[model samples]
Target: MDTPALIADDLVVLRGGRKTVDGASLTVAPGEIYALLGGNGAGKSTTLFAILGLIKRSSGVIQVAGHDPEVAPDAVRAAAAYLPENVALYDHLSALENIRYFLGLAGQTRTGAELDQAFDAVKLAPAARTRRVSGFSKGMRQKTAIALALLRQTPVLLLDEPTSGLDPAAARDFHDLLIDLRKRRVATLMVTHDLFGAADTADRIGVLQGGRIAQEWTAAAQGPRFDIQALHQSYAGPDAA
Candidate 1:
């Protein structure tokens, strides 16, 4: 198997003297999507932040594309694209403008044609490319952000609540975009509460409970990828189930 694009080994993160992520470990292989599923305060987002080097890990190891985020944050970030729960784009700027601005910030430059191509890859409407993002729907904003990620050519993607706020049709389109990214060998690690979305999109799903990985499930070769009922029981806790 290829070296994992992302790795968190015995990961631990603390906030205010409490362990937010305690010994949570997982991996995302190139061209694979791994969904980290949990409810509120389950340390899912904390795990993502630790990988991004935004939050210092109390202990354990983290490697993004062979670079340690704590040791070489710049290199780690360069090799990864992160989309937070709320994609931050200048509402006043058009989609192309937003992409251009971010690329410039990254010290990378792309021509007009390349920018358009990225937008096309994400299936953002041609007409919307030149309009202010303030008028765009949540899905449109997500597409614009993803286009920026594509232009960066990042090998890994970290997404937090990627499918939240999207309608069924828009979510499906977003999943298709993820499939294309997988085909391009981008390893994706997404944290979400969307069980249905995770079941439909992820090659593997890890359940995070009480700040640790409680259990995990992998997709099957044929038929349904998951037993939704079982997955739900795991996610909702035995009492809730």
Candidate 2:
């Protein structure tokens, strides 16, 4: 079997002397899209941050591409590309310029043609390439972020509410891009509240409650086999189910 791209075992986090994430565990294999689903304050974003070493874990283990994020942050960062809910970009910089600058920070430099190709792969308009991101819509900004991820060619991708503000068309485009990434054996972990979108795009869905994964479901080999009603109940609470 192939090594998992991301793994968290009995992970724990504390804030204000209270457990925010308790005994949370998950594994995302290469080429698989795993959705971490939950309501607000369910510790979904916190879990992502912990995996990225942005927040220190109180206990448990985390491995990204076989490297511990805390002990080997540089290695983990090199192997993982992260896209937060609101991707920050320079307003004055053009889409292409933003990508170039960010890639440079990662010690990567690419030619204009290569950058343009990445933009194209994300379905960003050729005209938008030179346009300042200040005038771009949320979807356009997300495409630019996706383009950066493609350029980096990281083995693992982490996304936080990636489709929150996107329209149906834009969201669809993003899902297609994820599928393409999977073909390249890139693992993906997405935190989202969109049950239907998770059903449509994720290879597996893990419901988080009280900072723990309370339930999990796998997509059928033929396609997604999610029971939306049950998922809704699960989100409501254990009693609701």
Candidate 3:
């Protein structure tokens, strides 16, 4: 059996005596895209933080590429790439420059040609490569961050609200980039409230409610993969009875 690229089994995280994430378990296999959906205070981003070792877990087994975050944080980090809702880049620096600088921080380097190729893969315009990101759009900044993730070459990716502010056209474009990553054998786990976007892009979808996986749906091998209306109904249902 192929080992999962990311794993969170019976995970629990507490903040000030309250469980932010309680017994949430999920996995993203190689080349798979898993979308986690939840409403406000659902602890979606908290889950990502635990996987990245940014926050300590109260209990549970969490692993990235076979390494435990608590035991080997460096290995876990090396095997995963994270993209938060806000893609932060130096406003005064160009896209290429920002990528180069961040890569340097990670003790890695890419030739100029390689950098351009990464940008191309993310659909970042050639014209915008040298322009300072101070004037870039949300979509543009996102593309640049994705390009950085591509250069990092991690097998697992964790995205938080990836399409939050994107327009319809831009969201579709971002979905295409994610599909491209899947082809490259990257395992992606994204948390978002965009039901339609998840229905469009995810190989599997899970609803998080009451700090656990309330339900899950997998893409069918034949016919329609998901029933959008049904999912919306389930998602729209009250978190508590």
The C-alpha lDDT values of all candidates are 0.93, 0.92, 0.93
Residues 18-95, candidate 2: write the lDDT tens digits: 888999999999999999998899899999889999999999999999999899999999999999999999999999
Which of 1 and 2 is the better model by TM-score? 1
The runs of at least 3 residues in candidate 2 whose Cα sits more than 4 Å from the true structure, single-residue gaps closed, are: 237-241
Per-residue lDDT of 103-127 in model 1, one digit per residue for the tens? 9999999988988888888889899
Q: How accurate is candidate 2 locally (lDDT)?
A: 0.92
TM-score of 2: 0.96
Question: Ranking by TM-score, best first?
Answer: 1, 3, 2
Model 3 per-residue lDDT tens digits across residues 107-175: 899988889899998889899999999999999999999999999999999999999899888899899
Clashing pairs in 2: none
Residue 69 lDDT in candidate 3:
94
